[model samples]
Target: MVRIKRWLLAALVMSAGVSGFMLTKGTSHAATTDPQTFISTLKSPVTTVANQYKLYPSVMMAQAALESAWGTSTLTTTANNYFGIKGSYNGASVTMKTAEYDSNGQLYYTNANFRKYPSAKASMTDNAKLLRNGTSYNTSIYSGTWRENAATYADAANALTGTYATAPTYGSSLISIIKQYGLNTLLDASASDSSSSNSNSGSTPKPKPVVYSKATYYGASGTQTARLSGQYATYRLYNHVKGTRANITKTAWSKVAAGKNVLVYLDMRGVKKDASTGKKTTWYRIRFAKNTSAKKYWVYTKALTLPTVKYTSGTAAVKVNNTVSGSYYDHVFNSPYLAKSMGALNKLTAKSYVADKQAIKTQDGYKSTWYRIKVGKQAYWIAATETAAAPQYDAVTYSAASGTKKLSAKYSKYTLYNHVKKTHFNQKTYKWPAGSKKGTKVTVNFKGVKTAYKTTWYRIQFNGSQTNYWVDARALA
Candidate 1:
């Protein structure tokens, strides 16, 4: 089942092409050279999605690039579904579908559940939300620093449980795309950096344009083309960061459009200088925003610290189980538990409960209890809720007294009602036996011929004790 699920998930990602793979150095350059037309049409909407959802712009862009090959996939073309999202949308969705597999090793075609949009931009915007909130894949990998132990986006993609085998190199492929285009540059690390700042009273530095295209300078404004504007005391642009000079005299807007999507380098107070290079720098990296209004630029407050290298020697058999202290139930209650009835529990004398096909003695005394029980190397109990009792079999106010019939000793009669499965039927409302009470409402929907069966009859199911049991099921139909 696990293997089949993994394959299905891989198919969804790979079928979409680029989005399935991780961004790494090997595949980045090849995948990133998507057409400019695709970029222009999709880029703006992608940025809008990032800003609205507070997600990293580059990650969104990278996923789109990977999924659609810059709007080239059949899924995207027909359904506007760049992510190959499954079909069965509760609201508006595309009718397009593709063949996939289930965990049972059966193949089926399902309409990919996708939110259809008027344009590729709208699709990009919706895709961001799906990525951030979707349960199938984890969005953490795209947002934060990758951790060693926890599963990230790449791991989640691989862990997916549907047809995803088409994209064999999905994780590595996406990573390659990110590195090639420097797409990870869209995340803002400024907030994390600011946490370590020594200055409490200083104002946060406004960002310098990272990719300014044109500029205007006049009257009271000072301009520098290649470097920092003279208006500010100190300003420096890092990699992927751009600066533009603009004039306030003519009331003209800054000419540096900077390619619409830009990563800005903001100022950080209390930055120190490298004595040898005479360069004033802080631990800063460039992050792109989806649009002009986006909270685009990010500057780190702390200096970049590199971790010390480590080395590992040979051979050792380490203990895999790290269970320090906990009861057996705590370890495996949610997983590997089986459903067993109280009658089956008592009859088992083996090391644990035997698998299906093993016959056991039936005890009428303990029938009300059904347990999600594990009886193997270790026996554990779960889902131990008591089963409800049968309804009363006596005269009632709302009686269906049409054609009453007698039943065989093993046969039970039941009336068809919405709450017939309920254990305690109201004796005042429905016809039932005189001695019946709340504890006798247990009856499985018996499969048999309707004409031969009684419309309503008494069914006695097990309770913990004999006296507590009562006649249950509907009176008559």
Candidate 2:
């Protein structure tokens, strides 16, 4: 009986040993064969998630490979938690041992709860949502402009270090995996497929034109207002039209000068075809801020390039009794360091009101001072050297006995005008300097009402100039 029992035991032992050996071989084979299969399985699901979330597929694939060990981790193989995402998914979860690092970067293992999904697709979708919305696990790391932050695989990979993983080399490891396997090709293929699908649908793809560095404004002409268009160019008050010359110009415009920006506003009223070129040319219009006579003018579309940069627009508080004195140019610039020349000022004058000031430090290390002033409603900057303070004088009454009454305090430091009319073109006439200094005395020869505007006027002889010109009475103090 004992011998029979020993034989049976030996047979049983041999059978058990054979079974164990087969199981080992099977596991080893799976270990060897599963990586490529796992990667292949991930491709479609990862791409789907990436496209839906505007994430880089290469980034998602690399992260999955690293986090799940090519789908071999117990968390991934059994629970389908590819990203080791730790949370409950519709009440499904698994408690597992995970390695983590504290603020000191020390690695340690701990038992924690992890999320479980029904399939790889669910896992990938959940992972994408986690990245898109972020979580308490690493709020600072993932909470940012999702689409812009994940626009590139490099950016997404770099964002994962320290925050997503404890290892400082986590980002580099994922990047290396992506590059080693040429996973970017998958992204290209996906994009090509998307393009093909779009084309097959007969949908036209129109890309927004990139704004280049330089643009010019073609001057406008006639009684028409110029139009400005485009997303950025919409700041200017003008009619917007799609796919027009103005829209194209605005889209491709960039700042050509330091502070000056320009835009070509198309005047639809003055569209004309050139007989010589056999091409249609549009008229462009520009208006000055303060001056009425020179308020609006038009130029041909061929004369100017569209403006690239958006100019700053607003009103500024004027300093009391402050004046700008300088050699004046008919053209006014938006900024002191001129890049954009808006239009001509009404009158060339030695002095005008000082609105604002800015001290600019140039790239070459030179400091420049710029003054802001209003022409009409538009504000502009000029060089500091062009401004001065008006002098104060006591009021004086006009008398025929003197035939040359001392200039009253009110008129002592006023903007001299050539003519006075009701219209702004005539009202804010050419700005001329009447006195050498603020209190400098001048001769008032005659006073009368302007026949055209029904406004009072004063005929005065300035101290320096022998020629006497008519100054408006309302212009006096």
Candidate 3:
């Protein structure tokens, strides 16, 4: 049985305003006949006011459109009051007939005094101040401190509908208008422009895209329906989050071939333990191609190779070695107290690259460190302890200048530690081969320093031997 989560109920309630206002019937004005023209003319002023108030311009424009009827209302044309702000401003006022709903939901017609602004810009600015600071007519809906609350456009619209408007659908109506015209895109574009301007002015650059691990699933490719059995044998596909399972029948299953790409939608849910292996692993809800009947599924986190870095726009370029060990996700949870297991790492490809590293706090309050790596375009996380810095020796050209240092004279002999291969810095010490003897007359091939260990190791080739070995400088005389 899959569990469903209720995360969107609060947003629905806030969108459905309980009370609403009715617009008074009036003749349209010829000066602002086109809705598009009216909206375009006011966009600049509306955005200015919204930015000053930390409110969404889309919400403000929608409210103005509703209250002024696209600038055709007599009150808007004559008094430049697009927001129906009622009060004396600079001692200028206009008496207008409007409809209001009483406490018992009864509609009543009444003549009220409205503020007269010098221009539409002034009217829009004053409207923002009214909502942000509040007046004798209503308390501040956004916040007592200016521009501190109302983090989103929907939040500002909801607050106005709940406290500033008398109509039940006022908030939803504003949202509809904003969405119908795709006004949020303009808001986003404006923000991007601001970020660019800030960068040109020598300010701190905008945040770069955070790199994460990319994962893949290796399952058989075919359309075979198989019922999941056993305790925790069933992999539930969630609509979103942990508890919201998809409505599709549990008996339906589609398997893809090993190394097939699965696009990951969300990775922040933390780790789940694999019941069969008793291994702590992270699960990714992945999206498959349209051709696949099962468009989405949850797979074991270990079946994919995580990259070392995920690059984002505005991030500084970092040079990284492309080689990594096969062991991934051994103890990479955001918590350290959890027991470590190699089952997850054993499922991934033998080698990958490290893209980035970060310290994270897991749900259980353990400080687990992780590394961000990429396998193709996808990102995944792995335990920091499982990987070591492997520099590309093939990319480095060996020359006399690079190997000027000779073997130390303190000791005359050195034992071979594994077959001569590329030296690894900052890694665990290699064990000496059994029955190996130390010799003093080895020819030094290269002298290099491992930055991670802060030590020097000599790459040496013994007389008439094709193999080379890396011996610590401390071990040679």
Candidate 4:
């Protein structure tokens, strides 16, 4: 009877201790065998959380991998609890068996309560909060791991050893995993965070370039030209990351590519080269208007196709077509090349200016056309709205003009007009930055007004030039 009572008492004590860590089974979030996919899954959120909390993402990332065994651990797979954090999360908890050290420094396994997170982001957020805010007893306990506090990620890792986990080698384990997996490449080049190396501290983590996402979005120094192949859904980039799905229709650059030949204004976003194979991908941002104040979209330079511009021998002429058109840098290029435009040559010089060459192709719906020309030794491509001999404008059509206004702004465009059709031929070009008369209010002499369709078109000529331009009568006031 004594032995029986003693055995029962021992069982009761075990049950009470085990109660702290319930061993009930729970559902998993996601499971994957591919290490790359697993890393990709947590990288963005971890980096974001690190950036937000001012912690070394490298150390944090290493901890996650070491703790979750590359996201295969039951805590991670079942509860998305990558850090094995104790207690309930948002009132949700999971019971799981975990390894713990005993009073004699012996390792033992027992069930313990762990936080159950809704997603990897939630788990990451909770971990970041702990590292940043520390525990209830000590708020700055993990401050040594912060980018501001530690000079390098190793220091941060070392700081976490006994504090973050009971293991004395936790820091070295994190450092080893970080090196083995190459998680330090982009430590200084986080999606939107300022470079960590900017601080004088040697503790800033060196980079192994954790590719958090498949898309490699980067900033560029200049502009290029490209076209949208089709309607691409747009999103507002948060943290410099493509985030927050927005209603595409609400933006002005919305639904722009509707099987139309309308050209897009583009800026070269830059070319990204793969570090492994040296393969390159050129990218650009699209704008609907010439102004920089408008929103822009991203596009692959490869998709902005321009059929080989086959030039024929012999000079051609452009007659007044009374519609606006565009011209490109003889070829679409990645700079040391520019994608700017200028108002085409004046009507008088059209013939000789195009003397260099003339050729046409099956243009989709080019509005108006021009070819390579030269002024002195400098080569340029100019356009005029006369009759284009070889080019055809077949894809889209424009409606008759309406609501004529003589409105002008500080950055007035140097627009060209066709006398025959009394319509807009082309606008002032971006004349390669300086030496432009875009906003000069040339003195005008009014010819007369032709009222039709509830609007009036007024014919006028600038004081010094014989070219007659029709402005809406309302333009004078």
User: Candidate 3: deviation at residue 430, Å?
Assistant: 88
True lDDT of residue 85, candidate 4: 76
**On residues 221-336, what C-alpha lDDT tens digit does candidate 3 reach at each position?**
22212122232223434343321221112222333322323333322233543322344556544444434554555544443323222222211112232244434332243222
Better of 1 and 4 by TM-score: 4
Q: How many residue pairs clash in each candidate?
A: 56, 28, 27, 25
Cα lDDT computed for each candidate against the true fold: 0.34, 0.47, 0.49, 0.50
User: 69-187, model 1: which lDDT tens digit per residue?
Assistant: 56555555555655555543336565545566775559887654444444555566555555445444433322221212112333333322122323445556656655666554433
Q: Model 3 residue 219 lDDT?
A: 32
Candidate 2 C-alpha lDDT tens digits along 377-423: 65554443433322212223333422444444666446565433321
Whole-model alpha-carbon lDDT for candidate 2: 0.47
**For candidate 1, what is the TM-score?**
0.30
TM-score of each: 0.30, 0.35, 0.35, 0.35
Ranking by lDDT: 4, 3, 2, 1
For model 2, the superposed segments whose C-alpha errors exceed 4 Å read 1-34, 101-108, 136-151, 199-477
